[model samples]
Target: MTGGEVAGLIAAIAFLILAVGIAIFVLRVAAVTKEVKQTVSEVNKTLDVVNSEMGGLTHEVEGLLVKANTLLNDVNGKVATIDPVFTAVGELGESVSALNNSTRNLVTRVSGGVVNTTKATVVARAGQKAYAMFKKNKTEQPTK
Candidate 1:
């Protein structure tokens, strides 16, 4: 071949080599960009999951607080109900003590009356016996 034709062929081959190197560099850059995008997507998904779990935990804590308040109210109401019963019991105790005192006074008065009646009966019987004995002795002694 002529010299000019040979030089043209060499120039074409060098141009092809430079194009291939630039294409390889572009492909490497595209691959690194795709990997970075995927990592960012995964981080967003993890944050979303954590946020949803926190919402559920907040609801559970609110429910527990409501239950505790209801239980406290029930205890307070029961105490209020029992307070009247305690007061009534104290009043009943006082009434029973008063009744006992009245019964004791009645029994004491009855006992005193019985003792006085017995003393009067004994004195009257002794006086009648002495009078009968004196009359019998006088009649038996001859006319005096």
Candidate 2:
């Protein structure tokens, strides 16, 4: 063979080797890009699920707050209702105290009056009996 033909054959073999290396590099880059795209998609899906869970949790918290407010209002209303009852009980206690004082005074007056009248009658009867006894003793001793 001629020297020029031999040089041309060596150059063609080197070009083929370079082309194969470039093709392998491109294929490896494509595979890495595909993996990156899949990872991003999975991240987006996870974010969507997290957002939905957060929304549910927010709704539950709102419901619990409403229930707490309602319970507090009910307790306040019951306390308001009992306020009047407590005042009425206090008034009833005062009335009972007044009635007891009046009853005690009335009973004391009645019993004191009855006792005075009985003492006066007993004193008067005792004086009359003593006078009759003195007259009888004088009559029995006068014959001498």
Candidate 3:
């Protein structure tokens, strides 16, 4: 072949090779894009489901909070209603304590005083009887 024809043939073969390479790159890129789109779609669906579940849970938690508040209020109201009764019980306890203290003091003083006084009386009476017996013996012994 001539030099010009040979050069032209080489150029054409190079072009063909370049076209095939470009085609392969494009196909690979397209396949990767398709896979990414499918993954994104699945993520979006999962997100939707999670959102729905969270929304339901939030509503349930709100309901529980409301019930708890209501129960607390009811308990507070009952406590308020019985406040006077508690006060009366406290006053009764105080009165009982006062009475107990008074009784204890009185019993201690009275019992101690009675025991001491009785002992003193018994000693005095014994001395008087002994003196009377001595006088009788002296009068009966002699006139001298």
Candidate 4:
């Protein structure tokens, strides 16, 4: 063959090889793109399921909060009803303490020598007179 013909043949062979290489690269890229598309579809499905579950969980949490509020209100109402009883008990305790203090003070005053000798003598004479009168009346009564 002539030199020009030989050069043309070599150029044609190189072009053919380059075209084949590009075809193989395109095929690999298409396969990778298909796999990526499938992965994205699966991810979307998973996200949808998670969203549905979250909605149900939120609803249950709302119900639980409502129940907790009701229970708290009930407890508060009961405490309110019992508050007067506790207050009355506290007042009763104070009253008892005051009575005890008065008794103690009276006893202390009586035993602490605050009563003078003259007053004591007068009290003793009055007690004797009252006893004598009681005995006289008892003896005067007729027995049936």
> How well is each residue in 23-81 modelled by candidate 3, as lDDT tens digits?
99999999999999999999999999999999999999999999998997787678557
Count: clashes, candidate 1: 0
Residue pairs in candidate 3 whose N, alpha carbon or C atoms collide under 3 angstroms: none
Candidate 3 Cα outliers beyond 4 Å, as residue runs: 1-29, 113-144
Q: Each model's TM-score, in the order given?
A: 0.36, 0.41, 0.55, 0.52
Q: Using TM-score as the measure, which candidate wins?
A: 3
lDDT tens digits by residue: candidate 2, 1-144: 899999999999999999999999999999999999999999999999999999999999999999998997787678557655555554554455455556656767978542223443444445445445544554564341
How far residue 93's Cα lies from its native spot in candidate 3, in Å, is 1.1
The reply for model 4, stretches above 4 Å from the true place, is 1-39, 113-144
TM-score of 3: 0.55
Which stretches of candidate 1 lie above 4 Å from their native place?
A: 57-144
Q: Compared to the true structure, candidate 1 yields what TM-score?
A: 0.36
| lDDT of candidate 1 over 46-116, digit per residue (tens) | 99999999999999999999999899778767855765555555455445545555655676687754222
- Reference-based lDDT, residue 14, model 2: 93
- The lDDT for every candidate, in the order shown, is 0.68, 0.70, 0.70, 0.72
Q: What is the lDDT of residue 120 in candidate 4?
A: 36
Highest lDDT, which number?
A: 4
Candidate 3 backbone clash number:
0
Order of candidate numbers by TM-score, starting with the best: 3, 4, 2, 1
